[model samples]
Target: MQAVLRAACRAAADLLFPRNCVHCAGPVETGSYQYLCPACTRALQFCEPPACKTCGYPYFGSVIAPRECPHCAELEPVFDKGKTLFLAKGPGRSLLHALKYHQGFYILKDLTRMLKETPHFKEFLSGAILVPVPLHPTKLRERGFNQSEHLAHTLLQNSDARAVEPLLLRSEFTHSQTHLDRKDRLQNVKNAFALSATANLMNDTYYILVDDVFTTGSTLNACARTLRTAGVTHLRAVAIGHG
Candidate 1:
């Protein structure tokens, strides 16, 4: 009865104030998602097996013989493995843009739903400690909220993760990596992260690093290096999007 009432209330509210699709900016009249309309939701791509173990970008074409993943070929991973929810293009890019740049906390529900439906991603987070790649104090102040931290919390809420820990702290306020090449990116984030005081390194516990996007894997590697130096043994990573 309560569920029916809530549904009816939501229907009435939506009727009064229709939502625009995050990707296409079209009216979201009918869809499984609240933010993404039916067309854009269908455009969203989910990552599956035959993906790169280092960065979780899906492989195209033949899978019998493995080929190098273009995304993380330059990334020397300090963590064990990695996974992502989707390819960061098309609808995926718009979703992240809204969240990271446009102050779209409403997008969290959609992301959480994606995480739940992506079985491998949910399974990867099981029984692990989720570590968000922290923003530097300056960056945090500017952004107002850390998307990585939010993503870590999302993982914790839906998975059997032990907890969300801000174990790695960004010490250096480096410029954005959006335009930096792999070599420049590697240099930019080098030694930019350090372990926080609360980072209780347990050799037995699996620690999964959470980030919003895996563009070059440089930031994630740096965070993993910090944790590894602090004595974390079982380390891996997961990102919401992989470009």
Candidate 2:
């Protein structure tokens, strides 16, 4: 009875102030939480075809071959495989910025919706424990919350998958690698992570490390290296976007 009453109150409130779409800023007639108008959502370049099988990065034109991109082929990723919901263009970029910089927690629902409905990622979740890449303590303090953690939780909650936050730790705070080249980025984060001493990882367990974006992939590689060393046999990853 209380739950029904609360839902009724929320419905009435939504009727009073219909939520606007996040992408187009138009009135949502259905009083829903979707941030994009249907038309705008269609206009966005959803990562459909020509996507790399290993990382799910949408490739334009005819050039790349199977199982890899120029980026991933040159140097293999530490993680065994990866996939993404969107190709990190159009509304993808804007929504990610909102989630990271503007505290757009509401985007979690939309992001998770995309993840859950993607057929490529649906049954591929077996043996996968969702793990969010960790932010350094200082960065976490400044940001007030880890955006990657929010994304990971969304994946877990929507997919009914087990999520573990205790498997990785930032051993020491390192300088941000936003401006660094790939080599320097890798070096900057070297020795920056350690497997939690209390982590009870089974040798056969598979983990899917989550993050907001995949740039140089140096950070995820480091985390995957640590997990591999800790006896984890199968590792996969997914990011909100692939830069």
Candidate 3:
């Protein structure tokens, strides 16, 4: 009854003040996603198979032979594999920015919907334990939330993932990697993470690191190194977008 009431209330509220697209300042009238207009929804470039195993970037349909992904060519990943939802361009970029910067919590429903409907997405996440990339204490206090942690929870609810484990902690408040080169980004995060005291990982179980976006993968690699040092043998990673 409460859920029904909430839905009814939301419907009435939407009618009163229609939601605007995150990418464009247009009314979201008809689209599979609630936060994007139909054109923007159609503009999303989803990742498909024959993708880069390291960063989940598509191979542009080149099935001839697997080649190195330019995105993470220099990365030496501690995790066994990586998967992402879409290219972090166009509407996809705005979607993540909205969540990461604007406190767009309402956009989570779109993630759930995508996980349920996107081909092979749920399968990739269904059986693993998810670990969200951590934010430093200072950053956490400033941001009031960790977007990666929110992503982990949404994935847990949407897929058959075992559980969400905050098994890593950012011990150092590293400078933001937004404008840094790949080398600088790596150096900034090096030795910045530590294994959390609450972590009780098993050798045989699959573990997947979750984040909102995959840039040069420096940050994720840093987190994975910490987990690997703590004896996570079966590990992989997933993100909403590959930038």
Candidate 4:
């Protein structure tokens, strides 16, 4: 009965609002939940094996054994491991821009669905709590929502993760890292995050940090350092893309 009621409500919503593709803003087919049209969906490139063991960045060459990428080797990441769903290019990049800057909440449903299908998403998040990389109050007000928090919540729908907890807070507002070099990017986020006063830290609990993209991984690393300082011993991260 509840299922039938939900179907009726969904049908009514389609009639009223009419769902549109989050990627291209085209009309979605009736009863279709794919937030992207078939063309855009096909354009999404899922990260496959032969990636860096530490950061999960896809490797271009053949692989006989798992290895850390040069970046991971040079400066170790604070998190135990990291995973991402897609390469940060083409449709994946456009989708992220739309969702982050254009109020594309509809993309969450399909994005989470894809994240759930990633190779190690389930295994990595199996016994963890979700901790979204936070935005400063100023940025939060401007954007109206934290994309990472939404991603964490959507992922929670299919995982055994305990809950989505915004335990971390941005202590300082920083410039955007979009065009910054690795050194500058790391410097930009330095001392930018801190554990919230209301947070309860469980030393034994695994916390999975969530984010929209991993570029130099500076932001995520900074967040991990703060968590570690606050006595969090086990950490992992998942992102929508590896830029």
Count clashing pairs, candidate 2: 1
Tens-digit lDDT track of model 1 for 83-183: 98898999999988899999998899988778767888898889999999999999899989999998889889988899998888889989989899899
State the weakest 10-residue window (summed lDDT) of model 1: 111-120
User: Which ranking of candidates, highest lDDT first?
Assistant: 3, 1, 4, 2
What lDDT tens digits, residue by residue, belong to model 2 across residues 26-65? 8766532377666657655555556765566778778645
How far residue 231's Cα lies from its native spot in candidate 2, in Å, is 1.8
- Which segments of candidate 3 are over 4 A away from where they belong? 1-8
Q: Which candidate's lDDT is highest?
A: 3
* Candidate 3 structure lDDT: 0.91
Residue 186: error of model 1 in Å?
A: 0.6
lDDT of 1 at 164: 91
What TM-score do all the candidates reach, one by one?
0.97, 0.84, 0.95, 0.87
How would you encode candidate 3's per-residue C-alpha lDDT over 21-55 as one tens digit per residue?
99997999777989989999989998888798888
Better of 3 and 4 by TM-score: 3
**Candidate achieving higher lDDT, 2 or 4:** 4
lDDT of each: 0.89, 0.76, 0.91, 0.82
RMSD in Å for all candidates: 1.1, 2.9, 1.5, 2.6
Give the range where candidate 2 is weakest over 10 consecutive residues by summed lDDT.
Answer: 28-37
C-alpha RMSD between model 2 and the true structure: 2.9
